[model samples]
Target: MALRAVVRSLSELCITVGVLIVLFVVYLLYWTGLRADSASDDEIARLHKQWAAGPVDGGAPGGGTPEETGGSPSRGQDTTGDGQAGGTAERGAAPGTARGTAPGGYRSGNSFAVMYIPRFGGGWSKPVLENTGKQTLRKGLGHYTRSAPLGAKGNFAVAGHRRTYGDPFKDFPRLRPGDPVVVTDGDTWYTYTIVARPYRTLPSDTGVLDAVPAPVDEAATPFDRPGRYLTLTTCDPEWGSSHRLIAWGRLDATQSASEGKPDALTR
Candidate 1:
């Protein structure tokens, strides 16, 4: 009888701990989701206030400068050579700009303002300035620390939770070939088109998302160059993140603020 009583008490304790963990998670989601929508001046202002107010190099800087990062054979060059869009990583372009490095345009403090995914049905999230940090990745928009600025000549990567914090990519798989993903700063919007689905690659598949992402099917080599690509990742289970699911896209069109951005594009 004593053993039975102890077992029941332990079970009750376990349940209590589980409940507390869930509550903590709920709070985390609330804070992160609040910022995932489209980037707005008001949003920026608030973030600036939270960040203690100062100009931040928009996008993520952990990935390094556009030219210094994401330029290896792993990224794969434009095998198609269509020329409509080669590749971009120009500095100062905006958050989530093209991966191909575009020299000479980069300036600091506000590269990307917003991110658009029609898969999410026009509702987008604002791009935030960040550096590679454990806290940043856990929140949303992990800076590459070693990559270029957003829209610079290299890749600037961001990460978010798959099940919590509104799970920004909850519907990301809905993106089809030629579907568009747009990122906008205050003045211009850079566009990307869905080219590939998330394929499992070794963590070494760095060049593609690196200086360039390497071909998933091929070995790492510069000549294996494919084209500029964007890899969107999230936890696979939908309910829990165990393995990662990645979605790929290619650069498409760019628009100025006057062009009328898509409806539901911003937060």
Candidate 2:
């Protein structure tokens, strides 16, 4: 009789532990994602509101209009793949030209831009916030603070999660060369074109964020000269972080805030 009680107690304990583990998994994979999605949406909305209010200090006004539905961009206001605009684009002191905290400098943990990838779908938009801290990533994509400014002369690197936290980079591996990754700081729209397939490397490979990124694992980088570039990174394997997957791009175009939307975003 005593032996039977011992076996029953052990079984009950095992069941309890299993239930706890399942609940934790659900929280990480489902509940956390829901919360992160909501947070990201809120950040995007906040950025739009700030832009509508104009420049924060004496800086250039937040220029881009809120995301719109089907409508043709005004004639002569479209941007090409070579960072040129057709019409007279507002090339005033846009924040994309600033490298520090002036009128549009990025603040730690605060969002200053919105990123859109056509390949990610028409409705896909994510807030690009400063800093890749643990908590900041829970809200949306994080910008590597040390990288170059938006559309600036060096590497502009950003990081996002592969799974959970809304899985912003869940499709990181699907991106291909020539894909357009567009970003807007409300003042200027910068479009970058993917130059190579995703490169997989260990988490310690920090050279990938350099001004002229060095080779990874002796693998040659597509960039041959010093130019404005964009680097997106996420965890590999879809479910773990033992390795990072990187996507490299070069600045291809820019549009004014007054411009409705860049071609990469409109079509």
Task: State candidate 2's TM-score.
Answer: 0.81
**Cα lDDT tens digits for candidate 1, 52-118:** 2111232144455432443222122221132323223333233333432333222222222456677
Candidate 1: stretches off by over 4 Å: 1-15, 21-112, 154-156, 202-204, 219-229, 239-242, 262-267
Winner by TM-score: 2
Local accuracy of candidate 2 as per-residue lDDT tens digits, 1-267: 999999999999999999999999999999999999999998898778656654432333323432211111211122222232222232232323332323224556777789998887788889998789998899999999898878888899999998998989888888999999999988789999999989999999998998988856666576878999999999988998799999999999998878879999877
Question: In model 2, what lDDT does residue 5 have?
Answer: 100
Estimate the TM-score of every prediction. 0.57, 0.81
Best candidate per lDDT, number?
A: 2
The CA lDDT at 123 in model 1 is 43
In candidate 2, list every pair of residues with a backbone clash.
76-87, 83-253
Give the residue spans of candidate 2 off by over 4 A: 55-104
What's the lDDT for all of these models? 0.49, 0.77
lDDT score for residue 211 of model 2: 90
| Model 1 residue 3 distance off true place after TM-score fit, in angstroms | 8.8
